[model samples]
Target: MKLEDLRGRLMAVDKKFKEMYEGLERNKIKSIIYDKMGKPVSLKKLSGYEIENITEKRGIVGVDGSINSYGGIYPHYISLIQSMAKSTLPKEEDIILQDVYVPLFEDEDGQAEDELKRRARMSKLELQAASFAMESFSSKVIFMDGSLMHYGIDCPSEWKKFKEKAISTGKIIIGITEEVKTKDIAEILKTELNLNDSILYDREVLFGILNEGEMLEFRRDLKSKKSESGIKSCYVRLSEDPQVAGLDFIEEQYVEALKYADLIYTLTPEKGRGIPLWLDIVDKEVKVTDEMVKSLVESTISREIREMLLNPKRSKRG
Candidate 1:
């Protein structure tokens, strides 16, 4: 019962969850197509959703970040056009991909720690904004910028609603993560369902391409951490059974996931190039760039903080 033993046990369980999920759910997969503008016109049509924005609430929002580095606010939009799916393959010609912009903000309090608190705050703001848009236009679906579990931890209200609806429909909600571990989604599911262990699996999933140069930054960070102290691990883990498939499988696997959706679009930032998610069938790296993460971080609390600062809190002591 040592602390390290317990931590190692948790990590082992995390690995087991990921391996199990990937092993079980690789066959059921689908994909989506979008245009350069980040609009899912082709996907909406493919999913049998109204192409003309028939629902007053049909649209995707991209977020990005603005940082005051060197005393100047630098706003960067994570940019990219993406297509998603579960088991079905997209006709290369039919894929009209679009770029989305999402912002990630800097955590004023924990910037020194490089804490991912911004991800939480930005996710909450994005959900709030998306929810307001949904209410304003009475939209049927809101394609959030990232994975479902990220939102659950960041914005519990929307996550609860999303889970209830997706489960009621017998639909597995798809979550895309710039980071690969499935821990966020699994945690949310376990908490929501109150299950000590439940079987979930990854269907057809695709990992976008990454070259050595593309991963250099990650290498540097990893190397730096090798000699650093007080560095907490952010590595995530999940439980799902997935099957192994080739890149060609992307079309076939994602198509199935698409069948469950009325519309499929990218609600993530364009910066990181694209957002990556786990595919049980493919046993390789699926890369979404850092640009996208930056976007969501930026958009999270920019306006809200400004407004809050302007409206000072009433003090009881005063």
Candidate 2:
């Protein structure tokens, strides 16, 4: 393409973007706010006294995991590790409960492949860890790094069991996700208000509406077979960070959920990353670096097996 043509195309896109930006700015005048339960709600900026210097008797647990795979071997293998922290102790001294599993696949089915196997294994490990945390640390809040909803379709029974156990034990389970793609709010606006903006995501819309220390709770529909047992979710902004995160918890524990959110805000650093500090600590502890994987394989497997497992195409280059 000629340079002139390229410049002309770029200018056309820029003009279109400016027009859309103006449209969004005008649309905000008629924007509607709704809670998780689809009821109309008003947004209030939380006061300093409401969130500052808050104290509670409940303990907090943060859970996160890592997964790595080696693909060239006969039985493709993945190393899965989950780390849970009961307290905000230093990373070195923290009594983090860890569960590690290496699943080897010998079948031709894709279910045994790295991605699917990793999701399944992580889901099982997280459920077990949440249960253990609740039973072991009574009345404490259990924080999982992602949605309580199981990602794989094959694990509905396990997922339902976890939710039932959590409800029966009266344990508070909070799932914090850094990124979200749910279109619940957008859909509500389009269907109910007759407003449509396909380009904006839930987070992007909420990002402009919510102030720091405020959250918008929405009731999710549980009638869907894949819903996470009627869990309620909220979009929260803990700090001055422009990004908003999704927080999911059981509907029965609404007050406790807000308390957990305040606690998370307190732990969040002013100038640090948007996530709670405790979550960052647990994530660092659980992350499986490439060097760690290499060390583990070298220390455990024989050199003959390692050489044989190395991808032949890569081996030939040497």
Candidate 3:
């Protein structure tokens, strides 16, 4: 396409966006009037709580893993490295956990070629580790790195059992996601409230709707076909970066959910990007570097086997 054509398309999109913004404003006014009638409101401003008021016990645990596969040889192999961080606050201390698993590919019925199994193994490990921490600690809040909703239809019973155990222990399991794709709230606004133009992702619609240290709760119906996990979520803005994140918690734990959100906001640095420092520490501990992979392969494999391994032409040239 020519540069002039691209420029024209960009200008058209800008005009469309302006029209959509005006429509949204009009819908907000209608929503306010409807809210006064005591109807079901999807979004509301949160007040009466400040970040300085957050003084609760928090025990945060994060799990992440890395995988590397070598498929060029006769016997394929994969190296999986997993790490977990357990942190207790008020007096911050982190206990690090690490493990490595090496699986040899047998090529039996093509099962060895499936990558999803590897991913599932990592997920299962992470969940189990987090569950153990939840059971061992008496902290009011327990944190995880991703969604608590298990989307895998084929997930094992143990995975569900661990989550149940954590919740049954009366500790709040909070999942903080940097990126979210859920459209449940947006769908609710369109279907129940008859707002047609608000068909964007939940985060996009809530981009600037929340102020710093404020969170908007979203309740999902367990019987709704769209809600597979029956989990309740909220959108929170932790800093002044104009970025919002989705926080998922169990539906029955509404009051605890609000407190957990405030605690996260309190821990978030005011000057840096909006994320808790403990999460950052765990993320760095679990990340796998290329040098680490090279060292693992060199130290584990014999020199003869290393030479027998195949290398791509470009890698060999370098």
Whole-model lDDT values for every prediction: 0.32, 0.61, 0.58
Off by over 4 Å in 3: 1-77, 89-113, 150-156, 188-199, 219-227, 303-310
Q: How much is 313 displaced in model 1, in angstroms?
A: 34
**Deviating ranges (above 4 Å) for candidate 1:** 1-114, 155-179, 183-262, 265-318
Against the true structure, whose lDDT is highest?
2
Error of 2 at 162 (Å): 2.4
Q: Rank all candidate structures by their lDDT, best first, as comma-separated numbers.
A: 2, 3, 1
lDDT of 3 by residue, 1-318 (tens): 469989999999999877665544535633642343113223222333543233232445554444555424323454545656466454644444444543443334354444555666666666666666675654656667766564233255765676577668876777777676777555654555466755566556556655676665544332333244546666667777667776777666655665656567666776656666667767777766767777777777786765555333345564
The candidate maximizing TM-score is: 2
Would you estimate the TM-scores of all the predictions? 0.30, 0.75, 0.70
Question: What is the alpha-carbon lDDT for the whole of candidate 3?
Answer: 0.58
Q: Write the per-residue lDDT of candidate 1 for residues 1-318, one digit (tens) a residue.
A: 569989999999999867655532222211111111011112222223453343333333222212211111222223333332212122211111223432334433444233244355445444444334333432243333344445555666765664454434433333333334333223433444354466432121222212111110112123222114211111111111122111110111233434323332221122322332213211121123455544544555475653433222332237
Clashes in each model (backbone N, CA, C under 3 Å)?
100, 5, 0
- State the local distance difference test value for candidate 2: 0.61
Residue pair clashes in candidate 3 = none
TM-score of 3: 0.70
RMSD of 3: 5.9
